[model samples]
Target: MKGYRISLIATAWLATIGVATAYEIDCPTRINIKSDHPELEATPEGWQVSINKNRSLLLTSLGVYSDEPVKLFELKPEIGIIDGKKHDLTWQINSAYDENGNYVKCSYNGEEVQLAKKIDPSMKSCWAIYANDENQHTTAKLICSTSKLQEVE
Candidate 1:
């Protein structure tokens, strides 16, 4: 009975590891980010990333309250970068929605910051990620992805 329980626990742990690996974000090594462009293009004169192992980056318009979209990526001692500088992304999602939503709340980041839309059960996406260089607000580093808009009951 002891061996059987141990085997079950090991299997469950392995499954959890697999799930975490599936959620890893794949970022480009380099891309040209220009203001008023359509999307991120491969260019030598663009932003380059020096990814730091075992770290996460939650990048927002740091030190100011603005409507820039939030980005959540893995980080370490170093991570994402842009404009010839290593990005020092330090913001974290500390809340969600309800009493148990504190882990994803955008409240602590900035007062005037634009918050991402919370995912609902009915929401779905194309799974294809994109980015455009349009200064809809401040910077043109917005991620341009398509998703189905569901009608809330």
Candidate 2:
């Protein structure tokens, strides 16, 4: 009878642990930038830049070429004012892959931004851009391609 009770208690504890783990949220990794405007730095790995409070860009080299800086990702504000009018900004990933596989994942304020997986064959590159607001949220692409990327309007 004591062994049966111990088994029951262990099973209940394991079930609780499983439930807690299943509900856990997976978060993306965030890079910390120290400057507010045009913070540019070059390291052996590659280059990083923060254009302003609303924009951050990173370029990493795979060492294919000596001087080429590959564009990895960019973060920008979702909304902006243009001509004294409010305008939505666009986010784009010009190139997201190479010969191996998908190579780009963009994020804003610590959240991953969904990008279209459309590869352009003619050019040896992939890129994308879009815009959103503080209250708006976007989805991510399941597959990475360059041809399917669309400009935000």
Candidate 3:
């Protein structure tokens, strides 16, 4: 009976917390983790996220070779998954363009991140850019594809 009770308690806790991979975000620019985790450092190469003493995590723009800075704003418990919890942080790192003018909004989500870009008025393309890294998955990598996105009107 005692063993069964223990099992039930464990199951209940798991349900409430859910799975770590189960957590999702649309644009995860920053990740918030609990204080219990190791120190998070933003190296020039990339971000060295110490999930714990046992493992490490790295968050970088999906790329092979580029010159975009592995942009990191703060170093602390501010964003991402912490103890099966979601901590999402967003910053307008560079909003001068947006302030200068307006463009169509982007819509996409990822496991731990999501970046939305507006449709460039002149280019007639919906380019999604994060920090200095533009969406290079399908585009021409560094340069924003001209007709990748349909013109919205």
Candidate 4:
């Protein structure tokens, strides 16, 4: 009877863990940028920004390529996973033209990440970094094709 009780308890515990995990999706590995403004570069020295779905984080680094001083910003955008979660994100690193202004969109999310600066006149498309744990250093990439979000009205 004790063995049966132990087995039942183990089964219940396992079920509870499974259900909890099922509520959260794994972070993505890659994210693709799709935009009319196509002049963008992803380099170590270039600007990179990433958002973590799990940690609810947003990170940005500037002047990564040139001798110019680097700047970093970490903020938390209003993000939540009701159903589909966007672990990967496309970013607006540079702007080429002002026709559409600088904008970036991620998958499964309708909001766009607009640039705060007017550095580039033209729009550029680029991928942002993976929101890795500061200690663990893990990366999440986008699973499929790049997302095309509708412009906010």
Candidate 5:
């Protein structure tokens, strides 16, 4: 009886340890655009930029919030030259309403900020991710607006 109890306790401890050591995958860097824009495209390296008339601008670097199902709504980190100085514009979606709702709350770096001027869910361009320039000269801009995101393998 004593030997059986010891074995059971050992098994339980091992199971607990295994559970504690389990790892979770971090979000990737990608953006999904639901609206129609002739000038914007996602790069092979997982960044979004504008390609207007053969001219391209490095808009932002995308970061994922979830990895399992790969959602489109995630982080936006932008690095570019503003006013002749390099800047990093990064932002994340802090909160948002359900499918029936129409509000999205976001945070830049650590401070709460406003999104773009327009947010219309019915237009399929409702949802957006925003980030501010590190210089503080600019507030926030819409990185990309999408209605939904597809799961990534």
Candidate 6:
């Protein structure tokens, strides 16, 4: 009876290892980031950039959040120079209806600050640090490539 039980446990362990390997895959090594024009809300979720007048590309982040954990989302916008062009992004989202059933939009009026220099074939990772802000808000969206996904030290 003891030998039979040990054999059963061994088979279960091997099956578990096989299933884990089957579901594992390597993420991308590099990603191209572009300005999500006409869309001001491009942070860690992904980026929407116009490649042409009628075409656009989208890149979104994937992960899970937990209680009071600190994380950094890195963003690398395409580098270039354009005269009289605006690079600022403004974020706005619709809020939950109030008791009177009125619709409203809350604005995240904070300015987007770049924490690292633009890399052209660049190797440096840009970081978007999220923590306690002046408004006592603890939530915000971030945009970054899969390669930039990492745990904060």
**Candidate-wise lDDT, in order:** 0.29, 0.32, 0.31, 0.32, 0.33, 0.26
- By lDDT rank, best first, the candidates go 5, 2, 4, 3, 1, 6
> At residue 36, what lDDT does model 1 achieve?
36
**Which whole-number lDDT from 0 to 100 does residue 62 have in model 6?**
21
Better of 4 and 6 by lDDT: 4
Quote each prediction's TM-score: 0.19, 0.20, 0.18, 0.18, 0.22, 0.17
Encode model 4's per-residue lDDT on 1-153: one tens digit a residue. Answer: 999999999999888652311111233323334444334476367655553333223322211111112223322222222113443333332223223333222222222331222223222322334556756444433222222222222
Off by over 4 Å in 5: 1-99, 106-118, 123-139, 143-147
On TM-score, the candidate that comes out on top is 5
lDDT of 6 by residue, 48-141 (tens): 5544443322212222221111223212233221122222221111112111121111112221211221121111112222334454544323
lDDT tens readout by residue for model 5, 41-114: 54568666654333212233223232111233443444543223333542222235323322233332232222
Model 4 CA lDDT for position 119: 23
Better of 1 and 4 by TM-score: 1
Query: Candidate 2 — which residues are off by over 4 angstroms?
Result: 13-104, 108-134, 139-153
**Model 3 segments beyond 4 Å from truth?**
1-110, 125-142, 145-153
* Residue pairs with backbone atoms closer than 3 Å in model 3 (clashes): 26-114, 27-114, 28-113, 28-114, 31-79, 31-80, 32-78, 32-79, 32-80
Q: In model 4, which range of ten residues has the least summed lDDT?
A: 61-70
**Candidate 5: clashing pairs of residues:** none
- Residues 1-153, candidate 1, lDDT per residue (tens digit)? 999999999999888662211111223222222233334466457666443433222223312111223434311212332222233332222123222211121321233333333322222211212343343322212221123222222
| Residue 98 CA displacement from its true place in model 4, Å | 6.1
